[model samples]
Target: MIAKPLAKIRCLKSAQCLDETTEDQIDFEVDFVFPLTEFDLQFVGCEVINFTRKIIERSQPTPKQLIGLAHALHALECLPAITPGISVEYGLQLRKGDDEFAEFKYWSVSINEESFEVTSGGSVYDSSVGSDSYSGFKLYVEAGSYGYRECSDDSYGWIESTVEVLNLGGVLEVSDDSGRGCIKGTDE
Candidate 1:
């Protein structure tokens, strides 16, 4: 039998804009809502915070003059624990000379009368040329444990095996299946 759809799912957007003529700078802000249902907010929130910090640290150098900006980007207080049927919002800001960008990570959770499924996916962007980028997904709660599958593009990247979890008593298993490919093109 097919599972029933969620009772309610909604997303809202919030934005702010600022233009400073004296400093010749402009700021634009927008809200990113993560639609999560039937998942632990604390578990996901911890991972999100850690992931955001890693991305920021790897993408840019610590700005001595912009300590506040750095702190704001890694603020964990912005995210609050959420209950089912509610969406959590995060603010994204863009300003001049900041080429740094955080790719939006997507997640979905489904719960039927008996079993549940959770999946999350996102791609990492490397600003520098010749660097590798990774895209992958993770599945939680297989036999009470978690498993994941990932793919990488570009040279010097390692291939990974696929992991699958069956709903029968949360048994976890891994397959030897693996593959890798690199896109060949000129940098325009």
Candidate 2:
């Protein structure tokens, strides 16, 4: 099958502050589009923080920033092109956000168009959400990096959130801010 260009893929991520004690986030949905026969989709999520520092005006992300976004987009959009019947793995990394700038990185699994299931094994973190085992599709960027490349480390303690597409019959495990864990779907 001919793989579609990156431009053909549709991506949506939003971030906002709901209140002082909580933040509103929307990261995943069904019917998400996947392009590429065997590529990766990075920079697919977003987050909303308290806006601690002054953000540079009119300054779009730098080449590094654009790369982080493009890299993630490429990885996620092509989730269906990887080896069929096999789970694909991805790695995401980002530098600490300072008053000046932040660094990011993304290493993702192959795509498999013949299948709709895309599984990713990695860690995610943020203030609102604690870290934990993460795997799911439909990543939502509520604020930081808008689901772009982010730093990963065992020292970060727990994973914040991870977005992945699972073929029907797969499983999804997630953790929330209150430090709760939940599993979705069951293999029957």
Candidate 3:
């Protein structure tokens, strides 16, 4: 049987990125680490802190910022079997925000045998109302040395390519559908 939803977090207004062609685009890379300590699943009642780094890019005429939202369930999926009685699952989404600048909002739910509750954007979810729910965070990235690039020989135009990993630590070299190259993360 599917385990009951225990704790979840979600980002509603998360990230944004604007692309301008006039600036000098350089190739660069960055690594985002989600250590086990951040999940804090060792304790049943402790609050898990959800967070993401921000990225900004400057160019003539227009500037862009990248942002996104994520959710997780059965958190145990990413952890080693050393810990017992802990589980989580998660998902994420990235899109444009409602405002001109990037904005972010989040929700969380914690469960114990006695009750099931949800907290989102400083408001508590009404248990009486039947609705779908989930959990996660947000991330933003802007052009650095490794920003968006046009595919050398394709009609696909521009592609933003990068590698992202959760839990395991390693070096990943990747390319976009348009064949633009990107190297992300680091070995640890």
Candidate 4:
């Protein structure tokens, strides 16, 4: 079965239009209400907070308890962005032990590369990931366009510097996006 996020997160996408009433930047706010499976994220905002916050709900603590993410969090590691002339669309998928992949909000976040300045939000992380143990999760990324090992000058691509945001346990590698975007497994 495909794993699903426990909750829904809304985030600010891009507002690249002038308002008809006033010549001010129109605040275009909308909810990407589509269901997110194990780990695909579309805009990358509150969900990242939801994930990083690690606001776990335990049966003992009034049926819902918030833990970890006690202190201020470090910069997010899973924020995937569209690079100019880089990739038209970018996505991250969580891999299961079954070798089947679970997707976050959506499979691919269509990037508006042409827009002068398009900004979106990405949840840092959530659930019990980044641990030596199961952390209850893993991720998947195919080769060809999605291979991260392809990092270097002639062969290298842009890499996201990452830091584990959980208060308690974290993985061996800090950067979630192995090279381009995403934390593969507990070891990664």
Q: Pick the candidate with the highest lDDT.
A: 2
**What's model 3's overall lDDT?**
0.19
TM-score of each: 0.22, 0.18, 0.15, 0.19
Assess the local accuracy of residue 3 in candidate 1 as a C-alpha lDDT between 0 and 100.
Answer: 9
Cα TM-score of candidate 3: 0.15
Once fitted onto the true fold, the runs of candidate 2 whose alpha carbons sit more than 4 angstroms away are 1-60, 82-188
List model 4 lDDT by residue over 1-188, tens digit each.
11122221121221111112221332222111122223333223444334333323111212111111211111121122222121222222222332232222112222222211111222223344532322121232221222221111210110121112222222211111222221121121
How high a TM-score does candidate 1 get? 0.22
Give the Cα-based TM-score of candidate 2 against the true structure: 0.18
Candidate 2, poorest ten consecutive residues by summed lDDT: 48-57
Q: After superposition, how far is residue 105 of candidate 4 from its true place, in Å?
A: 24
Better of 2 and 3 by TM-score: 2
lDDT tens readout by residue for model 1, 82-188 = 11121112212211222454343333332221122334444444466433333444333211112121222321111111111111111111111111110012111
> Can you rank all candidates by lDDT, best first?
2, 1, 4, 3
Which residue ranges in model 4 land beyond 4 Å of their true spot?
A: 1-39, 42-46, 52-81, 84-135, 139-188
- Residue-wise lDDT of candidate 3 within 55-89, one digit each (tens)? 11111111111211111122222211111121121
Better TM-score candidate (3, 4): 4
Q: What digit string (tens of lDDT, one per residue) describes model 2 on residues 1-77?
A: 32234322332321111111111233222222333221223332221010000011112335543333333233333
